[model samples]
Target: MRLETRDLAWSDTWRAARLLAHAYRDGTIWAAAGTVAGWRKQASLTLLYLAELLICRWEKGFALGAVRGDRLDGVMISYEHGERPTPWWGWLLRSFSCLFAGPVAVARCVRISNDLERLKPTEPHVWYAVLGRRDDSPGVGYALLRAGQARADALGLPGYLETSAGEEQVRINELLGWTLRDEYVLRTGAVVRTMWRDCPVKVAS
Candidate 1:
C-alpha cells in the first residue's frame, strides 16, 4: 500500500478538528468539568484547537491518503519545532473562566497545565505527530509516525510527545522506539505519559 503526506493547510482545519475532538474526548474526559466541559461544550472549536496547536506552534506536516484514487483513507497532523513559550495567559484565562465557568473548570485547567510542565524540554528540529483514520484505513497510525520520524531525521533532532495511558498507543510507541520519559496525573486523574525517540539514531540506521 502507498500513502502520501503533505503540510497542513488552513483549509484542513475543520477536518482536523473533528479527528482531534474524537481523539481527546475520551482521552481528556476525566478532567474537571470546567476544562473538559469547554472542550466537550465546543466540540467543533475543540477540533479547531487541535489543528491550531499543530499549525500555530509546530513547523508542520500534514497528510491525507487516498485509496485507488478515490476514498480519503486517513489524515495525519504533525509538528517539528519547539514552541516559542508564551506568557501564562492560560492561567489568567482559567482564573476568569472560574468566575463564569465555575470552580471545577478552573481547577481542571490549572491541574492540567501544572501537570504538563513536568516534561523536560527538547531542542530544535524535533517533531511530534497525531493521527486519525477513517475506520477502514489500516496502518494509518504507523504511517503517520514514520512520516514524522522521517521529518525529524531530516532535521537531525529528536521528537517528543505525551501519550494517553492507553494500551494500543503505548504499544505503537514502543514499536516505533519511543521510550517513556515522564508521566503526569492531571486533575482529572488520567495519566499522560511523555515519550521520546532519538531521530538521529533512527535516521542513521
Candidate 2:
C-alpha cells in the first residue's frame, strides 16, 4: 500500500487514538496503570482524552499520520519545547476527561509521564509524545521517524523520544542516527529507553 505522512486533523482524534491503543496495548508507560481492573479499557479512554488535548488544544502540539485512502496506518504525536504554551483549560479538560478513565489510571499515567519528563534532556527539542504503526503498515515507523527528524532538522533543534516497544525500536532509532541516552526501569519493572538525535541532519525527502 502507498503511504504518505501528513498532519492529522482534530476530527481524526478517535481514529488515531484507537490505532495507538491497539499498537501500544502492551506498552511500558501506559501499562503502568495495568493493576487497575479493565486496564485496557481505561487506557483506551485515557488515550482518547490525551489525543484530544494534543490534537486540538495544545498549542505546541501536532500529530502526523501515515495514511492510505481513509485509514491511518501509523501516527506520531509531537510538539516543540518553548514554542507555544498549553492553554490553562487544556489541563482542566484532561482532568475532567480522566474521570472516565478513573482516578487510579489517571494517577499512574501522571506518575509515568512525570518520571519520563524528568528523565528527558532539558534542552530545546522536538518531543515525540508517541509513535506507532499497524503491523500491516510495514516500514511506516521509519517513514514517520524520517518526517519527524526532518522537522527537527528544519528547526535547527534536536529530537527526543522514550520508547518501551522493545529492542527492534531501539535498533530502528539507532539506524536513523538517534542516540540512546538512558534506560530507566519503571516501578512495574518495565524498561523505558530515552533517545536523542542531534539536530540539522540533511534528509532527502
Candidate 3:
C-alpha cells in the first residue's frame, strides 16, 4: 500500500475516533484487561470508546494520524509535552476522571497513564507518546512511530510509547531499539509493559 503520514486536522477527529474504537476492539484484551469480563457488554464498550477520546485525544500537545493512500485505514494518536517534576494537573484530571468513570476505573486509568508518563525520557526535549495500532502490522506501526519520532526530533526531543498486548509489537519495539522500562499486572491479570525509544537521528540545526 502506498501510505503517507500527515498531521491530523479537525476533519479527522470523527474518523480518528472511529479508528481508535476499532483499534480498541481489535486489541480488546489489551485495552480492557481488568474490566473486560465485567464490562464486555455494549454499554461498557461504548463508554470506554468515549473514554479514549475524552482522555487521550483531549490532552494538549496531542497528534492524531490516519494512514492511507487517500483515506484513513488506520490511525495513531500521541501526546508530546507533559509534566516532569510532578503531574499536578494529571492528578486533578484523575480526580475528575473518577467522577465520570468511577473511582476503581479511575485508579486503573491513573496507573496506566502514569506508566506512560514515566516511560518518557528525562531529557529536556523528550515527550511521551501513547500509540494504538489497529491494523497489527509492523509496517503500519513503524510508519506511525517514524513519523512521530521525526516530529519529536525536529523539536529537539526524544519520543516514547507503551505496548502491552501483542508480542509482535514487542518485537517491533526491540527492532527499533526501544527499551523496556516497567511492567505491572492489572487486576484483570493483564500484564502491561512500558517501552521507551530515543530518536534515531539528531534534530536539524
On TM-score, the candidate that comes out on top is 2
Residues 1-205 of candidate 1 have per-residue lDDT tens digits of: 5665555445665655565555545446334443445544445335344534444433334343323243344555545564533335533433443455456654665567566755647466453544556556667667767776776777777878776747688888888888887877655676778788877665677
- Runs of candidate 1 exceeding 4 Å displacement: 1-3, 29-76, 84-103, 125-130, 133-138, 187-189, 201-205
How far is 71's C-alpha from truth in model 1 (Å)? 5.5
Per-prediction CA RMSD (Å): 4.9, 3.3, 4.9
In model 2, where is the ten-residue run with the lowest total lDDT? 49-58
Q: Give the per-residue Cα lDDT of candidate 1 at 108.
A: 66
Model 2 clash pairs? none
Model 2 per-residue lDDT tens digits across residues 66-114: 8988888988877786243546666665665576667787788888877
Taking all chains together, each candidate's TM-score versus the true structure is: 0.68, 0.83, 0.67
User: Which model is ahead, 1 or 2, in terms of TM-score?
Assistant: 2
